[model samples]
Target: MQAQIEILASLQTVDREIREQTGRKQRLLEDLRVTERQIQAKKGEIDALSAAWSEREKLRVEKDRVFQDEGKKAMDKRMRMSRIKNAKELQALQREIELMRLGNGELEEELIKIMQEIDAIRAQIQTKESEMAAMQEEWQKKQDELQVEINGIDAAVSEASTRRQTIASQVTGDLISRYELIFSRRGGTAVVEVAGGICQGCYMNVPPQLWNEIIRNEKVHLCPSCQRILFVKPATE
Candidate 1:
């Protein structure tokens, strides 16, 4: 019973370490997820800007074509005016030329505005793309480091689990099963010492007989309050 109690104690130590490692791994994974989400958000911003820039570029091209067509029409009308035989026909042609010229001027202004907008959009795209690149590099480094840490944690957890199994095997089957149940129920604290006639697992007072049984170390005893396995440390140890 003394040796069994010692094995249970050792098993508890390993189990606690395993739980801690598991928790650390989970936290690291959550951090990695958050970082990835941020990276995606940055990419989304760049993609939206890129789409806008593309649309603006298309509009600019179409406007330039329209401007060129209007200029050609104006020039053609001026050439036809040189062959006019009537004053009224000449005046009408002149009026048409003036209207076309005015329309072309407005188109020119619109084209200039579109060009300015395109330049602004391009600049924004450039800045955002650069920012995204830097953000990705930074996040990738953090992710790599986190992955390494997670791997270390995994290795530690595996080792602790193996150690737990080895220590648990030295204990009785029924005791080991009960310890597991109590460990889960008691928040990873399945075994605890009796101190000052109190159950250290819950700080509850232990009955005199129970305390004596724990002192005897004859068999596994459970705390009445918390149901955790009770043990007593050797005075020398």
Candidate 2:
């Protein structure tokens, strides 16, 4: 029973080491994911800006084409003005020329607006592209640093796992099984020290009879409150 208790204590140490290393690994992994997400978001912004720039350029080209077509139609209408003979026909032609000129002026205004919008979109695209590049570089640097930290943690975890296995091998099968059962249900603390008449695992006072029994160290004991295997340690350093 004493040997079994010693083995349980060793297993507890192993479990604690494993838990600490696992927590660190999880934190590092989360940080890596955050960095990756930041990079992706910046890239998405750049892509959106690029698409907007392309669409604005297309609109500008179509507007220019429309203006040119309108100008050509106005010239053709003027050429036809000299061929009209009747007064009524000449007044109708003059009215048509005035309407065409007004339409051309409206189209020219629209073309200028489109050109301005295209220029603004292009400028925004340039700024976004530069920002994306900087963000990507920062992301890469973070990735490299994170990779190094992850690698170190991986090695530590491997070592801790190996040590756990080694310690587990020294314990009897039944005792190890019982410890694992308690650890799985009780947050990796399957063993507790009995000191000052208290169950350190639960921070509850132990019964005097049981406390005395534990102090003798004749057999392994379990805390009444938490049911963790208890051991007695020397009071002095």
Candidate 3:
């Protein structure tokens, strides 16, 4: 019975270690996913910026075409004014020319503003694209490294599991079941050493009588407060 209890304690220890490793693996996997999403979001931002720049370029080109057409129309009207002989016709033609010139000036200012905006947009797009590319490369490298780590941890977990199974096989079924029940209810720690007259699992002080019983090591003892199996460590040589 004593040997079986010791075996059960060892199995629980192995199971606890396995749980810790499994938690670490889960966290690493979550980190990998977050990195992937960050990379994807950066790429989407770059794409949206590029699209905006393209649209601005198209608008700038269209504005310049309209400005050129207005200028041409104004010049043609000016040429026609030279052939007019009547005073009334000449004055009216002059007025029309002035109005056309003012319209052209306004169009020119608007076109200049559009060109400046396009230049600014282009610069911004270039910066964002460069940043996105660098981030993607970094993310990919990190993901690959994590994948290698995950594979290594998976192999280790498998080995630990096998070791745990072997340890469990050495214990009686009743003791194994009892340990598992305690572990399930107490966060994977069923057995704890009684050190310095306290349960190491919960740091609770053991009663005088229970402490003495634990020191005998003749049978399995449980902490009344935390319900963890208690064992006494041998004195150091």
Candidate 4:
């Protein structure tokens, strides 16, 4: 019975450590996911800014083309004005030329505004790109470090798992099965030490007769309240 108790206790300890290490690995994995998302979001921001810049650039280019076309029309009309002989015809031609010139000025003004907007958008895009690059670098470094930590935890968990298997093999089949069942149902604590005639597993007092049996340590006992296998440590002199 003492041998069996020792085996179960050892198994429980390993199981607890495995659970803890597994939890740590899960948390680290979540952190890694969040870190990756942050990098992606930053990249998305830069993409949106770049798209805006491209649209502005296209508008500027189209406006520039229209401005040049209008300027040529104004120049051509001015040259035709000197060939008119009739005063009324000359006045009409001059009015037409002035209208063309005014139209050209409006086009130039609109093109200038478009160019300014394009320049501003370009500057903003450049800044965002730089920021994204830096953010990616920072996140990648963090990911690498986190990965190393996660790998170490995985190795530890694997080692503990092997140890647990070895301990389980040393115990009888029925006892091992009972321990596993209790471990699963009792939150990884299948064995506990009794003290002061109390079922330490549930902090409830055991029957005095049962406590006496547990103290004997000649046979395994279960806490009636919590149904956990109980043992009593010998008094240290």
Alpha-carbon TM-score of each model against the true structure: 0.83, 0.82, 0.83, 0.79
Cα lDDT listed for each candidate: 0.89, 0.83, 0.85, 0.85
Candidate 2 on 5-93: residue-level lDDT in tens? 87778878878887887888788788878877877887788788778878878887888888898899889988998987889998988
Which residue pairs in candidate 3 have backbone atoms (N, alpha carbon, C) closer than 3 angstroms, thus clashing?
none
Candidate 3 regions with alpha-carbon error over 4 angstroms:
54-58, 184-187, 212-220, 234-237
N/CA/C clash count, model 3: 0
Best model number under lDDT: 1
Reference-based lDDT, residue 179, model 4: 86
Cα displacement (angstroms), candidate 4, residue 109, comes to 3.3
- Which regions in candidate 4 have their CA more than 4 angstroms from the true location? 181-187, 197-228
Query: Over the full model, what C-alpha lDDT does candidate 1 score relative to the true structure?
Result: 0.89
Kindly give the number of clashing pairs for every candidate. 0, 0, 0, 0
* lDDT per residue as tens, model 4, 119-208: 887787788778777877877887889889988998999999899889888998588888889989998899998888887789999899
